[model samples]
Target: MPPLPPVKASDSRAARLVLLVTAIGLISLNLRPALTSPGPLLSEIMREFGIDTALAGGVTGISLICLGVFGAAAPRLARRFGPERVILALLVVLAAGIALRGTGSFGALIGGMILAGLGIGVIQVLLPGIVKRDFARHAGTMTGLYTMNLCLGAAIGAGLAIPLEQTLGSWRLSLAAWALPALAAAIIWLPQAFVRQSPAPRAARPGRLWRDPLAWAVTCFMGLQSCLAYMMIGLMPLILEQRGDDSARAGLITAIAIAPQALTALAVPHFAARMRNQSAVAIVSIAVSAIGFLGLLFAPPSTALLFAVIEGLGLGATIGIAILFIVLRAPDSHVATDLSGMSQSVGYIIAALGPIVAGLLRDAGGNWVLPAAFFLAVASLNAVAGWYAGRDAHVLQDPES
Candidate 1:
């Protein structure tokens, strides 16, 4: 028999690329759902388990800390098992985590969240590298799509939690339903692990990342913006409830705010890429979000949804810009990898503090004003950091290295 023709091989490669992109999209859709779903149902979770506000906040904090710590380990896992395999394995674990969380025991809930967080962290760390490898010329577009889907997923997760609970008659069941999507994503991703694998790139040296002022600026911006984002996800529903909204209504309100993020998330990166610098965009986005927070704090309950929309749009753009900075400021792929590791690992750990603080303030003062003030302060700092990071300059290189 004649060997396969070159044209057919090329077509086969094309087909595989399409499948891989599909897999990436499906996986991205799942990342935020697991992270954000608990927020809308958090009140119920707390009541069911008799957990306090701070401990409820600690749920998000626990997951975030795992995201930071396990993310640092993901690159190593990918290198050992291959990126595709690691991702596939992680998806399965994510499914298991989501399922275990529905067991209704506090220990199971926390254990499940830890596993889910680790899975998400590892996959998040590896995805940009995968995009660069597979969609090099179109990395920006692919990443924009990924970010947009992440926002959409968050919106859906937050919005659906209450409705799902009402329909299913159990909050546990509602949470467990998310496992289906994770399983579906895993099935779609399975074929990629069998594809030809490349040797992992050399590990980046950490010395330069530590010395670079610009990298530090970028990291701060990333962390600060993440602080606001996590606060919105973990605390917004509760805040709205404090302002006199019911549980399901508060969840939908948070969903509406996050839903607009999909729009800005899709648009910001593309337009930012065309600009000379992204400083203005970054400032504008954070300012808009901060204003929303102020309104939520001071304005009447009638205006909450309007402020949420404003906040969501700004937040969507803020994060899009933050992720863009990781790619835009890096001098090369190795540097991008190191920058991503530093920003997400350190940044998310910093972000983890936001929810904990919000929870503590809620417990201490029993009001949203202090929490809103905390967010305002963080946003201000993020704006300053963003201004520096968004300047059209690469990270400063080390000398005598």
Candidate 2:
């Protein structure tokens, strides 16, 4: 390896900054669809495999767990190989995982999901540091953009999976189609990675993130929000189905619930930046999510779309706000990296419980009401955690401070 180039001030005048930010946003967009797309197709997958609902939900939970587990290791990999190269390599892994998932075997499906989850986890953990390093002054805006693209990707995957499955006459083809985007992102990312490589670089010493209380607070917020989001993605369709909605309508409602997130992703961080403290924003976002969950629990099937939109907006805003916390609460780039690792590592592990608990709840009650209530309770906890985490104070070990 060659010595890393020394950090120097560069011109981030408007035009160049826009280009850099756009590149980063596009790369981040490639991370979510594969993980989210499976949810919309859960019914079909269950039928094909002749499995019960709990098992189908477990498969999604397994993928999330893999994401959390693999995300914890991403920083070390980035340090060793460079962040850009790690991203490119992960994209390849993501593409291969998507392709293998279409194998139509239970074992292959589970294995592919694990691989895909790992790829997503690695990308998610590294992107924050990439943004902080590359757009130091404009980290908030860039974080918002990256988050919006992620939500957009999820919306597209959720909205289109059903249609694609129908058009191709098989869910396998629909699932496999996502691999193209991952491959294209890899190809585009390759040149950027090559252009930015340095032979050697400063080695950051690892620290005890587990011992940090603020770190745990941030992690809890991340985990709790993720739990709500994934639970909705995995179980919303079934919830709608039980209400006497047809399969197509259920899928459409799920899409509607996720689609508004793109707007929230863009708006939340921009607005949150104006506030002195993010605690108020976090409180409102989580409250909104709670309201949306209540709507889903009590609203009639005819009004499900309305509830979905409400939930989508809250989910989107919460995601943007969470990313904002990663930027606002960290003292500097290195601290941001540490915060990223801590939040994502523990957060994801916490998130993995959502699908499992929701699945078990459904199996126990044979209905969506309990699951909705469970999500509401989680959202409440998230709000509390976010309140503490959204403070302007820096973590104790934040070097940048």
Candidate 3:
């Protein structure tokens, strides 16, 4: 290993910075399609495998659980292999897993999803640290850009899955198509792997994150918001279908709900950076989401499109706020990594329960009303957690205190 050159502050350097950020953005675009594409194709998958809706939902739950559990291990892996290398390796893993999803066996499909989920989990945890380190002066902008790519990926996956399935003659081919983007990301990221070879690793602070109130606040907010998002992803189409909307219309509604995220995802982090306190924004975002849930639950079928847009706005803003808290609450980059690990690890584990429980409610009583109520409860909690996490204060203990 050797010392790396410093990032020069020059016009040419700025141009290179733009290119590097674009590459990273493309990599972010590969993270979510596999997980989300399944939702739109849930009925096709169930029919093909002769499985129930709960079982289909369980598959998503298992993937999410693996995401959380494996996400905790990412920082350690990054420390060992370097963040760039870990990212490249995970991209390969994601590509292979996604490509294998066309195998059509139930076990193979679940295994593929788990592997893809693990890759996505690791990337999600590591990319923020990479942005923080490489774009220190522009972390907020870079984070927003990367997150926008994530939303774009989700929207594209949700929007195009059915059409691709129709053209390819099976859901398996539609699912496997996501691997191409993952492969492209790997190719683009390869040059970055050795660019900063001897960079000093941040030392780990000795503290129990679970005991920190701010950490718990961020965790709870992340979990609760994710619960709402995943519930919509897994069950919204079915709910819409029950109201006499066809599958295509339901898919389109889901796409609309997610598409506005691309704009809000880019906007929230940048705006939050200018605010002295993010609590107001957080409260408003979650409240908006709660109202969106109510709209879906109680509004007439003709108004579903309007509700989708409202929900999408809230979802987009909540994601941005969650990531903003990661940077705003932590004292330094190392603490950001630790806090991210804690928040996402615990948050996702809690989030993984949403779909499973929603499925159970749907199965037991055959109604979406109870699950809709559950989403509202989660949204209320998200508001409270966001208020605390979005406060203008740090979570790390002051050494002199």
Candidate 4:
């Protein structure tokens, strides 16, 4: 089929497009910190709350679960109220959740994270659809930009949260500091909610993607890969600290592990778009991650830092591809919306278990090695899923009707 007609827009639409890209970039930066900032400080939080690692896993797991649950609802919400208005509202919700987390109460922190995750969930599901709609011709490049900023956010949080907490003399202030960015994003995004969406990217009937086997393949590929990425985000520092690295050093190692992600996140999508199929890239990327992770988990302590950068490269590419598939596998923006919702909603729920499972294994076995085994297995499964999902085909042509 011929490519969907390019968006023919008024010159004003060009101006709007520039603003939308900026808003999207800023919003993407906000997405990861709410989840990542706490990772570097997990030991401190655990000490303050007197909880074990398994329970600490809940800090990230709860948010992941929220992503799954609320993500499922985003498409319906967008369909009713329109994506822009809903995104503006959710940005406010994200800011509120971040501020709530600064309250320093255990209950408050978990509750805040849930709220933040819910907000993130909805926005996450909706933004890609907007990207696919507005930036159809440059989906891969735009996706790279978005994911690059997202990983940059992750690296910033991992590297700075601990230091910021130390410098501020209060973890609460450090945690709450993230709220400023979220609010700023909201302010920038506010105009979008009111701006013209004429020639809007809507289908008369945007159907569910849950029924298609290809959609499931894409979802599993996204989820299984995320399982590894989020697991590292949620636990890598703690695991390093346990190995006797100081908080600063541990955080630095974790930062190094993820810093490369920002680069790969941008570069991979650009390269993947040139491939015949993503299958070869998928297996190779996952294998590279497994090798790096195994070295980090079992190799000499001195090599951990080196292995981390390797792992980061693999994780970054996988995530970029997973997201690209959401757009590529679907026939158009409408289906992309449902596919994004389904893949992330279901995919993140699957990912939510990664840390919990790793936590349990560590708690029971008294080492990170067991979790390494888990990561390797998940990486293999992710490869298989990616192979199937990477085919050059759409999920199917018709709506449920």
lDDT of 3: 0.81
2-63: candidate 3 lDDT, tens digit per residue: 99887667966677667678778888888878878888788777878898768878777877
Candidate 4 C-alpha lDDT tens digits along 1-401? 88886666676678788999999999999999898888888988999999998889889999999999999988888878888988889999999998999887999999999999999999999888988888888988998999898889888878888888989897777777888899999999988898654234454243445667788999999889888988998998988888789988998899889889888889888788777688888888888888888888778888989899999998888888888888788778887888888999999999999988999999999988789889988988998899999898888654442
> Candidate 1 vs candidate 2: which has greater lDDT?
1
Q: lDDT winner among the candidates?
A: 4
lDDT: worst 10-residue window of model 2 = 198-207
lDDT of 2 by residue, 1-401 (tens): 99988655564345455655666666677777787778778888888889887888877788788888999888778778887788888989989998888887889888988998889888888788767776777766777888899988888787788898899888788888889988888876765588666332233444545566667778888888988888888778777877787777887888888888888888888888767788888878878777777787677767788888898999998888888788777666666766787788778788888888988888899777788778878987998899898877766655542
Give candidate 4 misplaced runs (Cα > 4 Å).
1-11, 198-208, 398-401
Candidate 3 local Cα displacement, residue 275, angstroms: 0.8
Candidate 1 lDDT by residue in tens digits, 1-117: 998756777888899889988888889889988778889888888888888888998888888888888887776676678778888899999999999988878888889889888
User: Pairing residues by index, what is the TM-score of model 4?
Assistant: 0.94
Stretch of 10 with least lDDT, candidate 3? 197-206
Poorest stretch of ten by lDDT in candidate 4: 198-207
Kindly give the number of clashing pairs for every candidate.
0, 4, 0, 0
Q: State TM-scores per candidate.
A: 0.94, 0.92, 0.94, 0.94
Model 2: colliding residue pairs: 2-199, 2-200, 3-200, 4-200
